[model samples]
Target: MGMNYFHQLLCRSSRWERASATQIVPWALKGLDLGDNALEVGPGYGANVATLRTRVPALTGLEIDPALAARLRTRKFDQLRVIEGDATAMPLPDTEFSSVVSFTMLHHVPTPALQDDLFAEAFRVLRPGGVFAGSDGLDRPTFRLIHLGDTCVPVPPATMTARLTRAGFTDVEVHSAATYFRFRARRPA
Candidate 1:
């Protein structure tokens, strides 16, 4: 996932980390079980990892960007594993995780079709009755400015719901907030 220089800086900023911890991640994950093992797809810069680490027993991050993944690995977070790979074609095994999540990262998938492939991968890697939940920034002017020269493909809530269903997830839910959208889907038990 390519990004402008400013965009990259913003992602690594302390302000973004605080906002993700206090605002985005909590709101997106409220009431979610996240079971024993949780997988975070495209955890750019590990912004959501702090809060998620508190929520889930074991956390694994799958990142497309090698640098970001390596940086996370350097941190040596307790009970966290950083994997460098594409979410659309994961290196992990099937029915492996109790939950699959992404936060403020789906838009970097480049295309809607590839985003669907990511969804399918989530479904594939989740155990029966596992949850796939996440939040994506909405398509807006300010974000567009920051995302110039970035591979951003906004996942509109309505369209995302359809995509999740097509990926064989049941009980799909997509809710829009002021700046972003939160989605939840379940692999049938």
Candidate 2:
């Protein structure tokens, strides 16, 4: 239900952070389309918020941390909508977004049930054909890996596909490299 400290240590290490700048950002950016309305979960530090808004003018950021949400307000991103809410229980209506993207936050979910809720919520909010891409550091032998305040769930490609199918998403694709795993799924039209 929580992140392992060791994984956090790995993420904070200079080498990991440096490598992420090259590996993670570009891959995450590929999932977003500027013309579509988007929703981001756990917009930590608002790092990707600016880039997201540039592509999807109606980009909404949902975070559970009040302090981070407050800091996000400092930017005059007129098109950005920042909301304080749980990813497992979003406030918006169904079919509310054209895309839903979450990165490195899946492992932070307290439990697998919560993780299921997150996937369900994302599906509920996405229009048919809407894309949902979420990435996490789970290239481990067990679910004991940790990153920052998140836990790696040891989700391989098959498991990820099954999880997406159970959540009512079709055409699931799992792309991974070393410490990164990105699950790209779509609501069927």
Candidate 3:
């Protein structure tokens, strides 16, 4: 799926860059075990990859955009592996990652059903006791404007919590702000 002009601009914007560093990366890193490998979905321009690599040395990023994935590879982080793939139907093995992370990207999943598929995929790839953490935008006008023509299904905290639980994630927690939300869940040990 090719990105529209607005989506492309957002991916390369400084605002987005700053958010990845200041907001997303820190939130995603919380409660993660450094000894375990990690995977990040939709890591645009790989901003979070460097920060995440500091904690989890072996970090792989799954980006849906082939162009973005190729761009990420050029950075040459020895511990970072960039894979061009879909989040809903990831081309990855089950129980492979100790943690799975996504940052403000779930809303781009087209529909709530597809977003649930992403949750299921995350659960499928996580090892027992593995953590899945991420932040996403709420259904607000400001965030909707940012997405432009892209598919944006801003999920509410309660809905997200329920979906995570249904996806077999335990210890699910969803925190909501006025315009955004963060979540953390664990695959049962």
Candidate 4:
């Protein structure tokens, strides 16, 4: 499927709505010291952005979809900036953010290599002792059907922890539940 079509499908799907809900954001970010400022990669329609702002007063969102990014900018959340960019190659300074977070978006990166790149980029942007936290769907027939023809790499918790370690993150932790996996890794100080 095309990128635009996938984006449209995500926006229309009730499942997507439930998965990207603000309530879930807190759970994904739990226990991490996000500090004062944070960055969210691939915040689909800015659902996580709204909740993240409640925790970290200063937040920036990197969205791959230009249209969605434009729409998010219209909301004009205080201390929130929406930048349209690729997750693997963010257009921001190094060690600028206190934390980096993503919610159920890594599978959309098309390949494991790209996903690793995303992890590295998150590490590159975060300050020393900062956190990189997120959650992603587990590999399952039902979850595979949800993506259908689209690109989805259901990364397991173990694999995710390895990738985080390879990407130069420390204190990696990956927790697996029934349908999804949540992870947290720290950049060394």
- Candidate that scores best on TM-score: 1
- Model 4 per-residue lDDT tens digits across residues 1-189: 124466557754667655666446666777667898899898766666656766887989998878778877886555488888998999999999999998878888877889899999999999999999988888898888767667677676788778899999999988877887889999999
TM-scores for every predicted model: 0.97, 0.80, 0.91, 0.89
Give every collision pair in model 2.
7-146, 8-148, 34-55
Compared with the true structure, what per-residue lDDT tens digits does model 1 show for residues 8-122?
9999999999999999999998899999999999888888888998998899999889888888898746658988999999999999999999998888998888998999999
Q: Residues 87-118, candidate 3, lDDT per residue (tens digit)? A: 99999999999999988888778888899999
Cα lDDT tens digits for candidate 2, 49-164: 65566567688899787766776666635657889888999988999898998877786776777888999999999999899886776656444523444544444555788888
Looking at candidate 1, what is the lDDT of residue 171?
Answer: 95
Top-lDDT candidate index: 1
Q: Regarding lDDT, does 1 or 3 come out ahead?
A: 1
| lDDT to native, each model | 0.91, 0.74, 0.83, 0.81
Q: How many angstroms is residue 145 displaced in model 3 relative to the true structure, after the best TM-score fit?
A: 1.3
Clashing pairs in 1: none
Please report how far candidate 4 places residue 66 from its true position, in Å.
1.2
Query: Which stretches of candidate 2 lie above 4 Å from their native place?
Result: 1-22, 29-35, 76-79, 139-157
